[model samples]
Target: MKVAVFSDVQAVLPALEAVIEHIEAWHPDMVVMAGDLVNRGPDSGGCLALFDAMRREQGWLPVYGNHEVWVLRCGEEAPASEGERDIRRFTDLAWQQVADQAERLHGWPDHLCLHPPDADAWLHVTHGTMAGNRDGITPGRSDESLAGKLPQGVALFVSGHTHRAHQRRTQGMDVVNVGSVGSPFDGDVRGSYGRFTWRGGRWHTELVRFPYDRERAARDFETSGFLDQGGPLARIVYLEWERAELLIAGWRERYQDAVLRGEITLESSVERYLRTIT
Candidate 1:
């Protein structure tokens, strides 16, 4: 079986375009989008359009990320303060524009399962762990710790959230993080995707990195008013176009203190962090 895996292509059409081209060339049997498809960048509507086109051309298996849930919550009807209303309005416009194709999974487990034909091993996919939980498996964590948390029957675990690409084999199982198709936290700014092949009792994993028109993506941010937001989004789209790592590291450093001191809840901290950046 050949599987193409990607995640965090948040409204960057050029990066998404490169990923689609690679998928066409590879012609994998299955394509998995680990999560965080929208609700951060200025081009949320454009992102949905791209997703719809991809689903029409090639079926997709999508998992839910924290951003997806945030969008949905923002779109729902609720009383709001003036500032909240402004944010919700933008969010509603974004959601209404692409709600049809933004497939929602209740949780991470909903996105993955065994490939039926081969029952010897199981395939598990997720956008990291469930919402509001940060202790999920990511590249920074040890393999033994990760294996202990995973469900039984999971021989191959694939995920994307930390935006880092990694492949590790432990106790006869393969654990892989597909990295980001658009918003990568690694020092490398180039978009990344992964291809996995299981043949003749062996598994092969390859990471594919490609360049996209960053200038165009940046221009969209300017047009979308994200630049004026004066938060993480500005840093990500304009200042830190070279890499997402510095911004992510700064956020982790800032929030870890709040979380440890119990000054803020995890949910609130995550919301604050994402709102600042997205």
Candidate 2:
């Protein structure tokens, strides 16, 4: 079995288009979008539209990201103030943009037992680790932490949400993070993705990076009206494209301080950081 895995599109339509073009060229049996399909970038509608088009054309599998959760829950119960209404409007446009082909999963099962007969073993996919949500797994974490959560019988575990491309092996499983496709934070603006091959009872994972038009993506943000949110979002996006380690390190420092002070919960901290940056 050959599969393509990616995540964190975050409204960069050109980047998304580039990735989809690559996926089509590769013709993988399955495509997995690890999460964060919308929010952050100026073009939420464009992001959702790209996903919807992919779903119709390729029938890809999508895992839920925290950003997706936020967009979905926006304005669901609370009354919309003017400011909230604007936010909700953007979110609704994003949701309606992808309504044609949005696939949601509560959690990834331990194993994907059903695969083509040619496939060597069952395939597994998750947005992050099996133990927790988006924050549970990251490229900087120790291998021991990963080895502990990986299932015993699965041949391969594929994930994203950390926005970094990495491949690690523990026990009998090949653990891979396909990295981000649209909104890469892997110290490079180039989009990152992964290709997996199952052969002879072993899985081979390869991290692939391709150059996309970051200037164009940035331009999309500017034209889409998110530039007015202040320069931080745009700066963060640009810096994230250039150097993800720095961004992650800065976030880690702030998050640790907030945690030590008990000033905010983890979820709230994450949300706050995202709002500030994106």
Alpha-carbon local distance difference test for all models: 0.67, 0.66
TM-scores, all candidates, are 0.77, 0.75
| Over 4 Å off, model 1 | 77-109, 116-119, 130-136, 229-233, 236-242, 246-278
Per-residue alpha-carbon lDDT of model 1 for 103-123, expressed as tens digits? Answer: 542343335665536656677
Candidate 2 on 70-162: residue-level lDDT in tens?
Answer: 666652445244333433444555555455544432343322333447655666776767774465456678876665676656777877778
How displaced is residue 51 in candidate 1, in Å? 1.0
Residue pairs in collision within model 1: 232-276, 233-277
Clash totals in order: 2, 0
